[model samples]
Target: MSAETRVVLRRAAASDAAAAADVWLRSFAAALPTVVRPRSDDEVRDHIRDVVVPLRETWVAEVADRGGMGGIVGLMVLDGDLLSQLYLAPEWRGRGIGDRFVALAKRRSPRGLTLWTFQVNKPAHRFYERHGFVAVEFTDGSANEEREPDVRYVWQP
Candidate 1:
């Protein structure tokens, strides 16, 4: 499958902080009910705001028109040789946004990259697989509220 919808990706600014936080919370929380279902929305949002949001520089994906709310449809956080928080909105899944995010992360992180995904998130597993990432380790679970097993993925350029 390919991305039929067009999107624009760019570096995020400090002004995007709050909205980006909301984007991560909304998107991940939505996914939670399905995989490793979180105990509460507040906990999920707390993880986003406290952990994921402040951890990395984020890239935002917006509709090509450049108008409307154009909230962050996708995001990426690169920390040295790691690619963290590479999430695309559910509606944007299966489109090329994720591939683009991965490509950008790889380009920005030529030393190699790694990421952690919920063990049961098959879609993400398959997506990472297609991007040439291999499972490197599996943890019993995150210390975070989800309490789900996590799989680590690594890609070497």
Candidate 2:
């Protein structure tokens, strides 16, 4: 669908876990070619199905269709004051979906918000920066599963 298509952002349901995880996997692959994922595809899917959707504050941005909510174009997971994850379909990037996700995350954690992203993901850095997130800490990746250098960003009102 084009950027003009109607998009709906809402809390994710059990059935949305699969599509939301797919969006994560695809976005990670397309946007992070240099970094290696710590988990296999099946592992990620299982985690999303068994843990993220059921336990985390997960949301999905889907296209609105005549039939109903269309395919999921974006996924977001907010944990308390942490914006744990926000990913969009590769083709769906630049369509303002990510912007909407960030706005929602901010509203969810109006006090403050924190998130992490790999240092190699420059686009992500720019996006978060544009959303008022400041890189407050940098890690050598030792503390993370991927062992890739990362930056910790924080946003406050």
Candidate 3:
């Protein structure tokens, strides 16, 4: 299937919790190998299902493959001015889905937005920078669950 034909972005619903969690688990496993203490699949799944999906403004990207079966492949969670989470399935990276999700967050908070990403996630740092976010702070990894060094990026209109 063409890339354009494969993905759909939408506001996440309660029914999407499981699929969203699946994307979260898969993406986290594939992307965050340097995390000092990564959560188990079950634990991540539970948090996505119970806490993130219900409590955050979440968006999901659904992908339909050649066989026409489709499932959630990406997710973004925004909390107030913070872009708290953004992840895409391994196959979905390099597409513009993440940019679209970030644009949505910017639209929702046009004045400004901020996000924290692990310093080791160079791809994410580049992505945010490409979207006009500037690195504003660097943290020594003490405050996060993974205890990985991190950077904060901010976007202002």
Top candidate, metric lDDT: 2
Candidate 1, residue 11: how far the Cα is off, in Å: 1.4
| TM-score, every prediction | 0.79, 0.95, 0.92
Q: Between 1 and 2, whose TM-score is larger?
A: 2
Poorly placed runs, candidate 1 (over 4 Å): 1-5, 34-55, 66-69, 142-145
lDDT of each: 0.74, 0.94, 0.89
Give the Å shift of residue 17 in candidate 2. 0.8
* Candidate 1 lDDT by residue in tens digits, 1-157: 2244468888766655556666676677666555555546566556555655566667888765423435677777777787868766777777788899999988898878999998878878999999999999998885645688889999997
Please give the RMSD of candidate 2 to the true structure: 1.5
Model 2 Cα lDDT, one tens digit per residue, 26-68: 9999999889898999999999999999999999998987656
lDDT of 2 at 82: 90
Q: What's the lDDT of the predicted structure labeled candidate 3?
A: 0.89
RMSD list, candidates in order: 3.4, 1.5, 1.7
Task: Provide the clash count, candidate 3.
Answer: 0
The clash number for model 1 is: 0
**Over the stretch 1-157, how does candidate 3's per-residue lDDT look in tens digits?**
3754678788899899988988887787788876755677788778888888888999999887777788898999999999999999988898789988988999999999999999999989999999999999999999898888999999999
- Better by TM-score, candidate 3 or 1: 3
Provide the lowest-lDDT 10-residue window in model 1: 63-72
Regions more than 4 Å wrong, model 3: 1-4, 65-67
